[model samples]
Target: MTTTNKNIENIIETNMMGYASYVLLDRCLPSIEDGMKPVHRRILYSMYLQKAFNLTKSANVAGQIMAIHPHGSTYSTMVGMVQKDRHSIPLLVGKGNFGMYTSRDLMPAADRYSEVKLSDIAIDMMKNFDKNVVDFVDNYDGTIKIPEVLPVKFPAVLVYAPSGIGVGFSSSILPFNLAELCDGITNYLRTGEKTILVPDFATGGYIVKDEAVFQRINEEGFGTVRIRGKAEIVGNKILIKEIPYSTTREAIIDKVVALNKSKKLQEVTNIKDLTGLRGMCISITARKNTNMDELLEKLYKFTPLESTVSANMNMLVDGLPKVLGVWQTIDRWLVWRRESISRGLTYDIQKMTDKLHVLRGLEKVLVNIDKAIDVIRHSPEESIDFNLQAEFGIDEFQAKEVSNMKLRNINESYITKKIKDIDQLEQTIELYKEILKDESKLNELVIKGLEETKESFSVDRRSEIIELTQVKPVKLVEEVQDYNVTLHLTKEGYAYKFKGDQEPMLKPGDKVIKVFETTNKAEVLIFGSDRVAHKVEVKDIDDTRVTSLGTYLPNMIRDKKIDIVSYSVLDKKHKILVAVYSNNRIAKINLEAYEGSRKILKNSYCLKQDLVDLITLQEDTKLKIVTDKSKLTVHTKDFNLTNGRNATGVYASPARILKKVEVA
Candidate 1:
């Protein structure tokens, strides 16, 4: 039994290791040779096999992919190939919605609803499919053969900037401008001098220029760089033309909305995400007398107007994961290209040499056409090749070609036409052999290819680089100017605010309950019957400027059913919250106990039955609790409420079920 258990343990360990290696090598990470993960390579290979070069349903392409890679998410990965906004050089040309970087909705249409075909660059990469350059391997079930890695002519890894996550490793090689990359590579090959490289995202933004960060990334394989959105003060408004990479334009708008709600962005009047089909364009209208500089700073500080993009540059090198920087990665690519081209040249030379031999033998046959025809006509088919070889002093292969020809085509004109090209073909074969032997000649060829690729595929850099510098922090609104105001709320949940002794907006049963004086930056705590305590900024309430009809607290809370039981301006002196349940019981907690990033406090105070009312009690505050039979008056001044957390309180009347509460 112990031996069996040990064998089971060994099997489990082997299987687990195999799974990890598969994920790290074949599944998650891209190979450095072709800059393609296994699934991506399989999809393109399947498309090539199926002749899916024309516009066809994406589902059809996906169905073709499933013959080799039935990974259940072929459609998703295939859709990503056509997301022009996400990839610098999209691999596929999709006819339907492939999603954009500006919009929050990233999901594409179903595969059956979209049409797709391989992009020009993808077709170019596979142009040498039949060439003996790249290795081919049996696919998942050994049903079909596919290229192990594509014989890519250009630096696909740098152009595509593929990113992935795997077991204990990840890769994030940011994209660069193809033209600049080609130039840099050619310069390095010629001069052996390295050039500093930076990322240029398809979603255009400003990358902060940090020489050290970029140097580390190019030299050491990892670094972080900050990308800032482009925003400028245009008249009274700020126009944002571009945003950081990896963050949607809608995300910045949402952050600004949240900041404005919390009163941190009170100066931003109208925030509109006007990002259209052209590019990212977000417009922000600032109020008059607003500190424009400070508003812009706040936008950057509080939102994803600026974000970080990290480059890890981890990838598979020969079925093993390794971290490679720009210099080393390009160097490896150059090596692969040289070897592949040499292999291609060698393959070409052998075929051309054999064709030259066959042409020469045919030339010899036409020299004595009548004798060749007599040898073929008289001799048996098995002995014809040997007879021609014996008579013409030629080998079996060349003689076989001479004997297999049609009698009419074995005439002078057709034979001469075929043999006339032997001179040019021999010259080409010699040139291929020379190129294979000469290293500089091979490099020159590679450079020529790079130049051609640049002319064909390179484009203008999308992201601009800016010098990194410390930015001045935006001053708080309260620090700029403190507007002292007195907050008032009626028993019917109407809220009002005023600076001086203006008569409060009043109606029947709506007596004004004045709270302590505070600034516009102050907060008001509103206790709802739903047992939630919501903290609203005093400026947000003051902006309403409600009158006798009043800003209804329930309307502000956005829930008409949550009747406001009690509300008070939160000052340091008033530090206790007393919650009254329907059981005539009272519990107290300090107002500071609810301080957090979130505004609403739910289920924090008591887990008892219904929370009939919540009261933010101050010194000298008296409450009259009314029951079915009699009224119980309790002065909160006598209650010791200076505690940080919830505290138990005695029942005012054990027999009474408290129905309502009012200030006495």
Candidate 2:
């Protein structure tokens, strides 16, 4: 049958959605209950089955787990190998060249070269799998069954927080200290209150712990966590001990090299990667008279040594994907623990009942030793099970156990041992029943389990959380030394800076139109024909060759093609004076009105045409204009000071043929 286009469209949409949901729920997001994605869960389960607690070849483990993990390619196997290194709290302990943790681009040795095994933590994560604490599902081929999730007793997720992008969702959970996470979990269990948890990186670093910022981030379950590399100044060297998470030593060194090459960090004389077995050490030697504090701040601003980690607690909850907060995650774990304990007890009680039934049958056979022997000696293997079930009134499983029993001359000691086993089984069953029935007892068991894991696996905090004041950006001017300089702008649009006493040699067409003296730290505003004010720092001008032509004003602001008509050094001690269009209009205003920290502005003087000249107003300020008709106009009091830059002023004279403007 032919399908309609609309029907085809619906099928496509349905299939895409199904695929996306599968990737999101099963493949990408980790379960909030166990803190494991599907592949990670399978690898651990396969390891447990192999009894790989002692060191074994990673290739051997990976080969065994491939039956359960569908996407168990070589790359995935290697990723699993590296993830279990010392960096990730080492759930799977690795031996022999697991690759460089400081450099992510480097690949680990082939699986044949590396050895791995379950750590105490990994063993803890899979402790109760055999006891029916977690659900099991059929493998890809449906021949074998594997666990749906691990019965992780500890806060495994927090200890090794996840980071990955998934279909229609993503996750980036920053790892926290094992001890602190246990404390947080304990606090939540007792009080049902959320606790603030900061990320702790394996690479020791400094975290900018702004409590208010983290409070909002944790409450929202998604935000950025600020972290900075650990650095200190000793003698002439700045030593970087540890870098931010996810940044490699090579990347940081490359960034510093680039910054130094650009002269943005010119104080550095040399850089050395003195990284040794102790830890990451980058020694940056400063030039003489360099400010070490400023260098450190600049490195933090420009290098990967400082970074922000995005925290998104997106994970699987009850087979569905969801984003959860810290307390919500803990509560889900609590619910899972309760269910697991109940199921485990039920599983235990069933096993004990089966064992006691078989033991009781065995005890009866020993008592009727002669009759059992006669029947077993004559009856076939198949008829023995039938005969024992008929005579003893036991179930098929009990009869089978009796038939399979070794003769050993039917001793009395064996019967006595069976009876003792029955008594012990009964006592254990009662204890398990009490644990399942008593809520307090269950809670105590959970807490005890958590404490045991903590005692075994807790490590010292690697990242230090410290209170930081608001980060006011360091001003470049504060780092620069101040000196007096003379700025010269020529009619040909060339800008120059020279020593206050030196005179620059001008080219044939070059004529200095504007000249001003200001400190090198001051800002000079250059008004262009486009009515835009472009700011240039005095120190930015080249002082190497005083006689050479400086930067072109038009090139400074690339988007606009403009000629420098007039310019003025912005100083707060004076008033701004401007002459518009050949001194035909002039105005004076306080400098404070237009003063801003911006480097570019439009329509600075509100001119209808273009600016002619500019200066600072003094008590004896004067202006002279020469008209094209050879007429001259002198004005001082005609144009009064205006508050607004946009306000138009009266023409200095009626001579419409305005020529040139000069300030005297």
Candidate 3:
């Protein structure tokens, strides 16, 4: 039993390891040299073969390679993904719907209808495929051969960013502009100078490019760039022209709608999805008299209008998955390119050397032509090599070439052509030798290739980079939405905000102390026994007619057994707050002294003692205070308007129990 258990464990471990390897190599991660997943490389190669056969249907491309690929994924979708502009450069140039950035309804067309071909970029990258620059491996069933990695002459990783979810890790390398990449590479090669690569998505927007983020991505293989949408305010509507990378118009609209529904964002009245064939165009309709700037900033905060794109550059290196930074990946790709070019050069040199040998043998034959012809004609076909070897001192390879030539072609013109070709082939071989001997020549060759590619196929930068400080939230004047909600707070500490059509609920001893209407975003002050006034947003409290919404009290009020005395939405009309305590101490304080505190209950800005009563006053209003001994009437002019915020007022009648203060 123990042996069986051990065997099972061993089998499970081996299978899991194999699965992880497959996921990282063949499925999830891409090669550092070729910058292609195994499947993508196969798909592109199949498409490459169809270039001469004219454009192939997307379905055929997928169908041809689907057998060798292990995944059960939809192949047409994969083709569309590679062919999509992605708001960035695509590997395959395609004609038809390949999806869009801003909406769900725009999916790629069916594989049967769509046509695709390898882009000039892909063609340039897959240069010298027939040469021995790359290695080929057997298919999944071992029936056919395929290149292990596409011999990409350029770095496909940056031209088209790679993203995948693999076992234990994933990769997200952000896209860079083709023209910028070409220029950067050229500049670096000419002068050992480096330029920061800011991610440029095809969907133009603003990127909060931080030097540190780029540095981290170059060193740590991971960092994030903040992207924000572009918008303008015209009259009452805010029109969004471009949104953040990977965010759709529908996504931004959904977020705005959610925020509005939850009362978190109240200024936006309607969201319009005006996206069309041109590009992303979303119009946000805001309420009249609304602070458009503030609302636009809120849209950035509360919606996908502002988002981050993370770059985690994990790629397969020599069949093993490894994390590589931006510069490291590029440098490694250069190394690979140079090596592939050198191999190609070596392959050429070797071929020319063989051709030169065969031509030289024929050169010997061009002389003493009659003797060679007599030896060949008289000798049997089986003994041709022996006869040639005996006649001239040429080896088996040269003799084989001589025997294989057609009898009719062995004439004066053929001899002249062979002699000319021999001279040219020898000169070409010598040139290849010189290039192979010098490293600088190879560098020049690589740089030339890059310059040619840039000239032919490089694309312009799409996304823009701005200073990080630009998108940081700024405080602006805010005028809340027009839909005002009425809030009712009782003396017994119950509070509820209701629409005009709703009724307020009350229990015994719950006397309504304050009734005021304000926007849902506006806050109302609550006075409690702690000698402090706390604030609660009209929207923060439950807006309902059914239940007694939970009391909007400070954390300390219930623990300290203090009843909420009053609620007031203090505005410009109310100035002084007169407080009458049970100890017969009454204080009149300026209402303007109250700071906008967020606490549910903070210390009152005016009152310093326990409250028996409180009243907000205007310039002409008179406060009538009734105490145990007498009633005192203090006119607004008589009150000290310049009193401190926490001052306890002088007694209405010294040494008398205070009762209440009211407008007189």
Candidate 4:
């Protein structure tokens, strides 16, 4: 054993594969101080050691970190400490189905299918580590596994830094929300000034835009802190909403489609198909009209959803490297959890005050057990050397302990009130182990024990105690009677109506239209057209138009007629005189009609020779005929048919020409 590199500078350097690659890169890093890592600080110290911190399941924090870190990587450290962009860790509040980081095929599903609790601000930072602040270790062999005390007592705002180098050292301190990081650390502790704001991360978004590179990585330990997100716009689409610190959801949907193809986001048109194990959504959409606040201030000024984060301070302690801050890494884990709770409460109050001083001397040896049972029922032959010379003044080999003594009904005022209650529990455990060795005297004895238990209050306070004063009920607004109906269109369409009460002669839809007694106004025509306001509801109505030749005669005969004629082509057999021919010697004479009178004398000599044909009138020049019941009367006169039906055959006469027909 002397060959362990001859006490390699007095041991403590087994970089067991660099502390298992720094505990698997601090379980995929987060937590310079509060960013959380090491499997989200071992599933929040295994849900505060199985009190189940509001337990939702994960087999109750995976069977309590498999009985306190039994090491076999309990389901990849509860799927990277319940994922969902790891919400930049602040004690990882609660809710459920965390799992995200853009799809590595979304793995997180087990904790009895998501729902592990502890987030009334993570159970008030686990009751501020029950006042001891933090310290508990040993998970590798020497079993007392985990509790190296991290009961997180609030006032945390670490931004990052802690170092190491020989393949070691890294820590990035994170935690933030002590009343909004104490209003940005009380404006950088009262104007040592530091603001380019961003901070809001319970995993929501927006952090980017160089605030002088995270204020020179919070004043020089290292750099980077960008982070931006929360784009939203939903309807025309933008989306993203959140993601940064340790990204994931498939690298935040492949960095939001490579920042919409390097900022060409003509409203991102597609980069969706997500997957980091059932976690996705980077959608996008709006290819136009997309100023969702100038695209979330250009995605917080040029993309990564928002990022930068870095702060490489490094860590290593006794082996070298050190560059810490953010309240010196929470005052070096509150001075190693106040010296490991003052050496485990002074070795558990000196091992229960030395077992109450050996049960107070076994209550005086059971009050002498009735004079050693009457000297052992009368001296069984000198009763073992006279009961060891009268109760242990020792003789006869200590009287063989009084024949194998077994009388143990211990009482004596219950072992003298358990040795005065173990000396008042070792002075109340060394007065809370000397107020956990001073972090401003344990934050001034926890603000004087919460102001003496909040000055003995009432009304069951704790809904997370935020009542800054109390009056919240002034809501009496009911004066909305400006029923809004004002219409006034009088370019001759007339309308004036009003009626909140009886001025009822206004007849459009009768709830009163066209009633404007000088602006108690109501000229409601609602929309167009006119009559008594055709689709009536008239008020101040001169929406004019009333020349009705039956509604403006089909719009003024489709705007002024233009040679209006219908159809005319008269020529049909001119000898057809059926009657009524006034001023042409045939006043009302149908004379019992005829049709074949030599085709009505060849269509009346083609309309009496103003003809286009049939001018054969020689044999027809002096022809006259008449017949009334076949009694004929004829005369060789100018062609004429007189006195009866069919007029005995072909005499015809029908001419009245005034020709001028050439309308092609």
Give the Cα error of residue 612 in candidate 4, in Å.
Answer: 45
Candidate ordering by TM-score (highest first): 1, 3, 2, 4
* Model 4, span 560-588: residue lDDT tens: 22221111011122222221111112211
Query: What TM-score does prediction 1 earn?
Result: 0.74
Candidate 3, superposed: residue stretches over 4 Å from native: 1-11, 50-53, 73-87, 468-664
Clashing pairs in model 1, backbone N/Cα/C closer than 3 A: none
List, residue by residue over 88-136, the lDDT tens digit for candidate 3: 6566766677666455566777778877666666777677877889888
The residue-by-residue lDDT of candidate 1 on 245-284, one tens digit each, is 7788788888888877776777777888776677667999
Q: What is candidate 1's CA lDDT for residue 596?
A: 57
Superposing every Cα of model 3 onto the true structure, what RMSD results? Answer: 15.1
Considering TM-score, which of the candidate structures 1 and 3 is the better prediction for this target?
1
Q: Cα RMSD (Å) between model 1 and the true structure?
A: 9.1
- Candidate 4 regions exceeding 4 Å error are 1-50, 53-83, 88-115, 118-224, 227-243, 246-277, 281-304, 307-324, 359-664
Using Cα atoms with residue i matched to residue i, what is each candidate's TM-score against the true structure?
0.74, 0.68, 0.70, 0.27
| Order of models, best lDDT first | 1, 2, 3, 4
What lDDT score goes with residue 310 in model 2?
A: 79
Per-residue CA lDDT of candidate 2, range 186-297, in tens? Answer: 7766777778987788877899877765775567667788889899999878999988886878898898887677656666778888875676689999866677887788
Best by lDDT: 1
